[model samples]
Target: MRIVIVGTGNVATVLGRLIIAKGHDLVHIVGRTPEHTVPLAKEFNCSWSGFSELHVINADLIIIAISDNALLDSASTFHTNPVPVVHTAGSVSMDVLKNVSSHYGVFYPLQSLRREMMQIPEIPFLIDGNTPEMIALLENFSSTLSPFTEHAGDDQRLRLHAAAVIVSNFTNHLYALGE
Candidate 1:
């Protein structure tokens, strides 16, 4: 599948690498700044563009892996398209992408991801879509990236995100005390 990834952070970089490694075509990398986007695009050997140029790129899937705080405002910039559009956010609702495309969904990765990690960890994706068909399509696509995939609604994802935060924070606190 041909894919376009938005954002230049950990999630975007990690996911983009995974997509390309799986024999998929990474058509473009769109970010807020050229400084970050250009280098990532060079690494992927794909085109790079700012959010303003997003409408021109054609791809099978567009994944918005930006920060949760920027999602609402950034979502409005995406021109409506027929291709599937998804966000890798755990706390946000899938409806945030409704205006971005006719087919929109959530492609939330359940595990923590860091681009600098020496080994890629097993990521279980929690996915949801606007329609049943869209949900199925996201599930199948997610399966190609990870062996674990599940259908999760807005409430479920939000709850899981909260738990993940608590667990992460507590672990950090323990490490700090140990130190």
Candidate 2:
């Protein structure tokens, strides 16, 4: 599968590495900042572009791995893409991507991800699509990256995200206090 990843943060970098490692063609890397985007593109050996140039790129899949706050606004830049588009956001609704493409979905990774991590952790992907065909496509693609993948709707994903936040944050807070 040919893929284009947006954003230059942890999720983008990590996913880009995984996609390439899996023998998938990472066609392009798009982000708002060239400083970050260019370096990442170099690492992946793919073309780089700013958000404004997104429309020209062609890929089988486009993953918007940006932050939750930027998801909706970033999605607006896409003018009805033909390929399937997915976001790695847990809290944001899949509908936020409705206008971005005819086929849109959520590919939320339930586990915490950091670009600096020496080894990739087992990511439990919670995926959802606008249609059954889209869902199947996402599920099939996600399975290649991780063994643990499940279908999760908007409400379920949101709730799971909330719980994950509380658990992770609360555990860290306790450890801080212990220190």
User: Native-vs-model 1 lDDT?
Assistant: 0.90
- Candidate 1 residue lDDT tens string, 1-179: 99999999999999988888878899999999889999999999999999998888888889999999899877988974888899999999999988889999999988788989646777889999999989988988888889999899999999998999899999999999999
The TM-scores of all predictions, comma-separated, are 0.97, 0.97
- Residue pairs with backbone atoms closer than 3 Å in model 1 (clashes): none
Q: Over all chains combined, what TM-score does candidate 2 have?
A: 0.97
Residue 168, model 2: lDDT of: 99
Q: Could you report the Cα RMSD, in angstroms, for every candidate shown? A: 0.9, 1.0
- For residues 1-179, what per-residue lDDT tens digits would candidate 2 score against the true structure? 98999899999988888888778899999999889999999999999998988777788889999999898666787753798999999999999989889999999989888899657877899999999999999989999999999999999999999999999999999999999
